[model samples]
Target: MNYMDEHILSLKNKLNYDVASNNVNTSLSQTVISEQDHSVSEKNLALRLGDELIPLELRVILDGEIEVSVPKSFSLMPLEQAKFKYPSEHRPEVIYTSEDGTVNITFNRTESTLANEELPEFVEQMADVLRSVQPIRNWLGTQVIVNHSGLSIGLIRFIAAGVDKNLYNEILLFTHAGQVMMGTFNCMESDMEAWLPVAENTVHSLHAVSLPLQSSLEKGADSL
Candidate 1:
């Protein structure tokens, strides 16, 4: 199955959501990426969240077809480790995770064709689907932001009931090259206050770049 399909199955089996996939955990690591770490050839991408002051890094990932600012401490999740952390045979296409596998930022490119103006209503429709599928979840509503490139990004937040603990789930939807990209930021429900802004800023920092078709989003390192 494709990444999105498997992700949706994992969502249903683990996080009590409807037709979407992603998860999060506890404790943010303290590994800093400083100015000295960046080369002159790259754009300096960074952000600080709350009193914790976690640093962000510029990463061209998914076979180097997309540019995103993620926490400096995040790493691509290993396949073996992903199985237990996500508790599913299916998971997101690219998963950048914490040391303990509790928190995550995931990306999955879907075949859906989306237009710029349709993002807000599309996000609402997703919310309605989740509501009908799991009304017991703590509903935290949704928001829409247009990136610097005028791409509309849809953000949905909620507290999801998990088998062991609750998770603060944020679902992001946007399009690039007229195709949908579903990304997610998740952390422990208890850590929502500290991680929420990190998630938001990370989404704001998202932008795409051109690349050869051979190094496209269609393929990438499954684990690291």
Candidate 2:
């Protein structure tokens, strides 16, 4: 069943009415959730190019639907790099933002009432949103790159490759600008593409492990 309409509407409702008031208003709802009939897998991979230890979590949202909440540090990059304007002709939602430095990203089908014949387009739009965050997979190597461009979004990219179909086919990353920001992947795929803040620490971290020297050999080996 296609719950696109219902899903989108429900999401809007949740955002409009579900806020706690106490001097601090924190929106409450199920943000960052995957659709049914899908599996999500996350892993921590070391980068081969940097000295920093990066935590990359891979989540595959199958049957494809994902909702993500954003961190306060992320935001739209302004007119030159990021556009915060809502889609007049075609735009994504600006789910959440706070003056106290809080942001949430949300994505789903448009609530403009999908025509009976618009299912294909609707699904494609949803897929495009999901595809925007897919990971770049390097089969022959042990590294991938991500570029996340959302508003004040302190994004943490995930890298997951070589998994059974039952595990994942799509990934999701969260930022403050919702769909306004852009992300890029570094690997190649015939049927796949990548998304989000270029992973700078994974491969570089894996290469930093050093091996101890032998008593006789007096040599040390390092991980790369």
TM-score of predicted structure 1: 0.71
Q: Report residue 111 deviation for candidate 1 (angstroms).
A: 1.8
Q: Candidate 1 residues 25-68, lDDT tens each?
A: 44453322234333323345344444455557777766666788
What's the residue-level lDDT of 176 in candidate 1?
Answer: 83
Top candidate by TM-score: 1
Q: List the candidates' TM-scores in order.
A: 0.71, 0.22
Score each candidate by Cα lDDT: 0.65, 0.26
Q: What's the residue-level lDDT of 58 in candidate 2? A: 33
Top model by lDDT, which number? 1
For residues 75-153, write the lDDT of model 2, one tens digit per residue.
4324322133231323233332222322223232323443334334433443333334333232122112222211121
